[model samples]
Target: MSRLYVILDVFADKALAGNPLAVVLDASGLDAAAMQRIAREFNLSETVFLLPPEDEDRKARVRIFTPQRELPFAGHPTVGAAALLGLMEAMAGKGREATFEIEEAVGAIACRTVASGKRAGRATFDLPRLPQPSGAAPDAAAVAAALGLAPGDVGFEGHAPSRFDAGNAFCFVPLAGLDALARAAADPGRWRTAFGGDLGAFLYTRETADPALAFRARMLSPGIGEDPATGSAAAAFAGAVMTFDRPADGEHLLRIGQGYEMGRPSVIELGLVVRDGALSAASIGGAAVVVAEGTLFLP
Candidate 1:
């Protein structure tokens, strides 16, 4: 059988910049194993399978997959898939700023998209769940060892190590500077010591390469070496930031710069609504461009 698919660049401000995502449009008959295989074949950080929504009220059902396994939820895939869907609707004469719902492993996700008048569009989604502490984070030394950095190179602005999960769990490691962020590399031997298993390690620093950005970050995992822009991590980080920074009640925004090391510099916009020093809500937003559309031959 053949399946229709679209390739998109998520969180990108320009073509060829940002995380690449492959969205399978006609994914009704494909099994979970087949989806994983397709994701592997694409060799990107993630792929999305768009199926008919199980719930009539939802716009679509999306399943996200890494090369190795299917994720309950993912950032770029959601944003990319939502943008593609919105663009399709626009081409069909639908108006801009469409609000829709996507059913995922994490439950129902509310998404809003605005057509950019270009080949791309912008997407924002309210987090299905608020982030909370997942587990005790490894000490800075252990995390540094896992990331191939010195203990002294770890930590800045009093932001130590922490673990948080919004929809996905991530070990947040705060680095001292951009130099430390740039030098980070995964050491398989120390990976277990840091995260207790092969888990997503989010390395970030306040010293951003771009003056306009609030932070510089990189996501390192087992199958996906390093993610250019990571939305899920940013979502969870918002929770951690709210916990640590405890910003005054109201809306706070953060512009994250990522993927520069891989040459696919990307931007992720995070919005947080805090009330009485607690995070009441959070949103993730970014731009996605439909880079290619084709058919996928599958067994």
Candidate 2:
């Protein structure tokens, strides 16, 4: 059997700068094991399989997978799939902007997309669930050892190691500066001790390469040593920002730059709606470009 798939650079500032994602449109008959195999075959950070929505009112049901396992919800896949669907409609003489719901393992996700060009688009989605502390995070010294950094280099401005989960869980590590962020590399043997999972650590710093951006970050897991961009982490990071920044009640926007250390610079826009010193809503938005399309054949 042959299935249609689209490859996209999601959350990119340009053509190839962001995280790459593969969207399989003809996933009617694929099973869980098959999807995992396909994700491994693509070898990208994640692959999205678009199936008929369980609810007719929704647009689609998207299944997200890493080479390792399935995810209930993911940031880049949601953005990329939404943008691609909207762009496809526009290319077929339909409208430019669309609002739809996507059903995932996590829940129904609300997404909006605007076509930017023939092959480019932008997407934003409401947070299905607000981030909350997952559990106790390891101490600064333990986190520092996992990242091969000194304990003093592990934290900044009272921002220490913390764990949170929006859809997926991640340990957020704040470094002292961009230099410390750049110097971070997961010590394979010690990583599991610190984060306790494959999707382990999200390291960030207040310092950024782009002066206009709010922060710089890097995501490191066990199998995937470093991720170019991590939307799920960013979604969960809302908790961190809200906890520390204590912004005045209103809508606020933040830009996070990532993947520079690996040469794939990507930008992620995060929006927070705070009211009464509490978070009312959060959003993640970014640009995506359709890079390639092809058919997948299986025996």
Candidate 3:
């Protein structure tokens, strides 16, 4: 069988500068095993398979996968898929902006896309579920050890180590500064001990390469090595920001820089809606560009 696939750089305005995703547009006949195999073949940070939506009103049913396993929800794939779909629609004379819903294992995600050009667009989606604290995080010392950092480098200001889950769970570790963040590397052997399981770790610092950005971050997982940009982790980090920053009730937009260490340099926009001192809603938005398109042949 042959399937149509596209390679997109998510969270970037240009080619090869953000998290690259493989999107399988014709995934009707593929099973879970086949999808996993294809994802491994692509070997990108993540891949998405678009299927017919169970609900007719929805745009599509999106299944996200890493090289290792399938995910209920993911950030880059959702954004990239929406951008591609919206751009295609516009090129077909649909409209410049589109609004739709996409189903994932986490639930239905509401998405809005604006076509920026013939091959690029920006996409924003409301998280189906808000982030929540998953459980107690490992100690700072453990986290530091897992990330190849000193104990003193583990935290800064009101931020510390924490865990949160939006659609996926992640261990959020705050670093002291850009120097600490740059020096940090994940020691896979100590990962399980630090995060208490196979949970991925999201390391961030207030110091950013771009002054306009609010934070700089890196994500390391046992399943996927280093991600260029991580929307899901950014989604989960909303919990950390609410817990530590305590922004006043209203809408707040934050730009996060990631993938710099890998030379990809991507930006993610995180929007939080605070009401009466509590988080009511959150969104992830970014631009994506379609870099390559081709047919994938499978046995």
When superposed on Cα atoms, how far off is each prediction in RMSD? Answer: 1.3, 1.3, 1.1
18-67: candidate 3 lDDT, tens digit per residue: 99999999789889999999999998878999999999999999999888
lDDT of 2 by residue, 7-100 (tens): 9999894778899999999799899999999999998989999999989999899999999899899999999999998898789888999988
TM-score of each: 0.96, 0.96, 0.97
Show the lowest summed lDDT stretch of 10 residues, model 1.
238-247
RMSD of 1: 1.3
Best by TM-score: 3
TM-score of 1: 0.96
Task: For each candidate in the order shown, give its overall lDDT on alpha carbons.
Answer: 0.89, 0.90, 0.93
Top of the candidates by lDDT: 3
Comparing 2 with 3 on lDDT, the higher-scoring candidate is 3
Q: What would the C-alpha RMSD of candidate 2 be, to one decimal place?
A: 1.3
Clashes of 1: 0
Q: What digit string (tens of lDDT, one per residue) describes model 1 on residues 182-215?
A: 8999988888888977778988888985788988
